[model samples]
Target: MPTQNPRVNVVLDNFLYQNVRLLAEKDNVSLSAKVRDLLKEALEIQEDIALSAFAEKREKSWNDSETLTHDDVWS
Candidate 1:
């Protein structure tokens, strides 16, 4: 069974629209479906980049930490 997704209206340049239409025809999917797939793919890529940046920041912060013992603090 197919799922029903929300509908949205978007404006694209003629050239881009034609390209997407051709791609959709080639893939045997509706224009809206192809656009949705592309948008989802782009968002996922952006999410991956953001997560990678966060991980790097955490790694650097962990590496920059300085450990001290109770005696070291007293002295």
Candidate 2:
């Protein structure tokens, strides 16, 4: 049988491999699933960091006089 999902091959050092294997065993999942979940979590964290930086930059340039009120926006 062949899988329809895309496949990726990664090479991990012995220490990392063992850690991933242990996590998979503890979660009762395959190594691939564990890696996929970890990668997803890492990406989400990266996105959150990027968004926070963007918001901080925008905040630095914010001005109350140049902004609209809630009622103004609704009207």
Candidate 3:
């Protein structure tokens, strides 16, 4: 079954449109799908960075020792 594609009209500069078209060809995806994929990827990357920052905050609360104790040094 063929799925219906949504219709959207976006205006871009000629150069930008050409670049998008080239990327679409290289990736073997329709321009619309490529744009949607790119947006999703960007959002996911942003979310990952935010989660990593939150993890760093949690890690700092647990581990504060920069210098090793005698036990640690011996072990």
TM-score per candidate, in order? Answer: 0.72, 0.93, 0.61
Off by over 4 Å in 1: 1-4, 64-75
Residues 1-75 of candidate 1 have per-residue lDDT tens digits of 765966688999999999999999999999998999999999999999999999999887874258677898998
Clash count in backbone of candidate 3: 0
* Candidate 2 overall lDDT versus native: 0.99
lDDT of each: 0.92, 0.99, 0.88
Worst 10 residues of 3 by lDDT: 59-68
Q: Candidate 3 residues 1-75, lDDT tens each?
A: 766986668898999889888999999999998878877899999999999999999887875567678899898
Q: For model 3, which pairs clash? A: none
Ranking by lDDT: 2, 1, 3
Question: Which ranges in model 3 have alpha carbons more than 4 Å from their true place?
Answer: 1-15, 63-75
lDDT of 3 at 41: 96
Q: What is the lDDT of residue 30 in candidate 1?
A: 97
The positional error of residue 30 in candidate 2, measured at the CA in angstroms, is: 0.5
Clashing pairs in 1: none
Model 1 lDDT, residue 20, Cα: 96
RMSD of each: 6.9, 0.9, 6.0
**For model 2, which pairs clash?**
none
Comparing 1 and 2 on TM-score, the stronger one: 2
